[model samples]
Target: MPIISVTVGVALLLVLMMVFKLNAFVSLLIVGLFVGVLEGMSPLEAMESVEKGLGGTLGHLTIIIIFGAILGKLMTDSGGAQRIATTLIHSFGEKRVQSAAVITAAIVGIALFFETGVVVLIPLVFTIATAARVPVLYIGMPVIAALITMHGFVPPHPGPTAVASVFGANIGLTMILGIIIAIPAFILGGPVYTKFFKKESLEIEIPKGLFNPKEFKEEELPKFGISLFTALLPVILIALQTIVQIVAPESPIAPVTNFIGDANVALLISVLVAIFTFGLNLGKKMPEIMQSLSEAVSGIALILLIIAAGGAFKQVLIDSHIDKYISDIMAGSTLSPLILTWLIAAILRIAVGSATVAGMTAAGIAAPLVAATGASPELMVLAAGAGSVTFSHVNDAGFWIYKEYFNLTIGQTIKTWSVMVTIISIVGLAGVLILDMFI
Candidate 1:
């Protein structure tokens, strides 16, 4: 009965958001409350759950989200992002530019979260597409594929990070395995799948001035080396932290390393450095830099709100004992733990449209499976991560970002973006399964 009620509540959420054109944030809140009450929580309890969920989610993410936005905005405005794109494009040339996008996105996605990477790279992708005179999907697919793959599979991003914590996965091993899986997933979902889209009509009329490179002289943009370094700082710091802990656990600098390597602190430092390197160092004034930061925050406001609501819905599911429900069912199943973990996460992802929510919620359900099946916790983390990103459609903010950024109609977005993500998901699952056999 509880399972059926949960399913119906999720269905109602979809109907309200899609058919009635209701706001996703409100719909999520409504569904979260409805599900809570259906599961026998008092109305007051449901309300408290929603409030607690919202506060907890936002509290954990607000710093990272805001700082990431600031960094991306400053990078874009100061032409550092453009510098990286231009340098890479010239080096790769028009012929290999699409491949360059995949590599570039992987590098950037390692440092920036998915939303920040997308915002920073959107204009660059369009610029490459226009200059190459190719369909946006040609360049866009590889770029999006790389970003999504990294965001889903890699550490530091919320989904995999939280799942790893829940499942007691080795973060360093998970990162290593994630990169191995991501390579094939990107190739299959991105460049290979792109062949199918190339045959179709791929006309995309971007919004006015969307991809136009800022009016900056050759000397105005940050140098390629510096720009790339700035963008990759977080990854480097985090990597150093991991290395130091492994190599010299009691080193006096461990505390300093931890501080610099903390995700939020890393991003905050990056943003501060960028304000100088991408802004003041390039002659932009304080007010101009502040304006860019303000614009970045405004653009992500809705996305942040939606994520918060998804978190609320996720909390409701956890508090409502769905994890217990799932654990009981899975305990009796004979399926491979890897496949079962992926299935649960994928279903939750489809229902909630938030990868973090899906991964975290599924992690809670699958935690006991780790002990029951004695599966590698790292593989479980990857499996859950893969499922969390399975199919992005109308309910996911990422779907809308791709649709609006590429100026695709609903159908076109599904045909390209949705299909590409599905490919990523399936390939990711396959990669994890294949690795399971050997490892």
Candidate 2:
């Protein structure tokens, strides 16, 4: 009965979102309450579980998401992102433009979320494609692929970072393994696969006013060195702490390093630096900087609500015994935990159409399995992250973003953008499995 309720709960969520066209926040709340009651909990108990989930998830994530958004907004608005793009394009030149586009996108993507990164990098994608005399898809595929991969697999971008918090995965370790997994995924899905795109299909016009680089004067952009440092500062601080903890276990600075190296603290510091470097240092007034920060928070208000709702749904599953029921079922099976984790996330992603929602829900369900089997939380995070991005088609906002940006028909989008993400997913799963062998 509990198992049936679990299946029905997910199906109801999909129908509400995809068929009825209900709001995801309302739909998730409805499904959470419905499933909890069906699973034999009292109605009040179910509601309590939902509230607990909402508070727990938001308590851990609110600050990180807000700080990340502020930094990203500052980076985009102050011309720092354009600075990095310009430098990478010049250094790579026309001959190596493909590699350059991917690198620039990856670096920029790290600091900006997937959607914002796309908005910032689209101009550069078109610019590079025009300069290299290659098809737009040839260059654009690598750029989008790199950004999507980072959004799923890496930290400080919300999805992976939030899942890491839920599963107790070490942020530093997840970042390390995610980078290792992401490089090959990017190469295989981005540049390598791009060679096979039909020449005729690549002939798409750059959409007018889709964030043109010419809008900003070269002198107005920040220097490349400062831009790059500001963008990657959080990653550096976190990685440095990880390395130090491993090598100098008894150092007196451990406490200080741990304090600063904390993901929340590191991002807070980066946000402060960005406010000074991109805002004040660029001669922007205090009011202007404050507006950017406020607007950044406004943009993510819906996303935060959806995340909280998903967390509510997650709590219902955990509290109502669905996670345990599923864990017990898996216990009797011979499947690998990593593969199982990926499959569950992939299924939910296909159903829910939001990678963050799918990843969070899947992590909640898979939590019991990790506890029962003693699986490595880091690999589980990567595996779930990998699944959350698989088969990104019509349901995903990214699919539409790709389609509209490239001016592709639905079929063309499935052939190009969808296929690229499928490749990333497969490559991500394979990487996690391989990593599991040595660890």
Instruction: Name the candidate that leads on TM-score.
Output: 2
Q: What is the lDDT of residue 97 in candidate 2?
A: 87
- Model 1 stretches with alpha carbons more than 4 Å out: 110-137, 154-178, 196-213, 246-252, 318-322, 336-338, 344-384, 393-415, 434-439
Over 46-94, each residue of candidate 2 has an lDDT whose tens digit, in order, gives 9999999899888888887888888899999999988998898899888
TM-score of 1: 0.81
- Candidates' lDDT values, in order? 0.79, 0.88
Poorest 10 consecutive residues by lDDT, candidate 2? 205-214
Q: Per-residue alpha-carbon lDDT of model 1 for 1-439, expressed as tens digits?
A: 7678667776887678567878777888998899999999999999898898788777877776677667767877787766787788899999999888888888777756677677778888877888888877788878988999999998656567656766777665687789889999988988998887544476567677555444778988899998998887766776677778889979999999878877678778888888888989888899999999899889767756766776677678778887567667667789988998899889877866777667765665567677667789999999999999988888888999888777889998888778887888888889888988887
lDDT of 2 at 29: 91
Backbone collision tally, model 1: 0
Q: Estimate each model's TM-score.
A: 0.81, 0.97
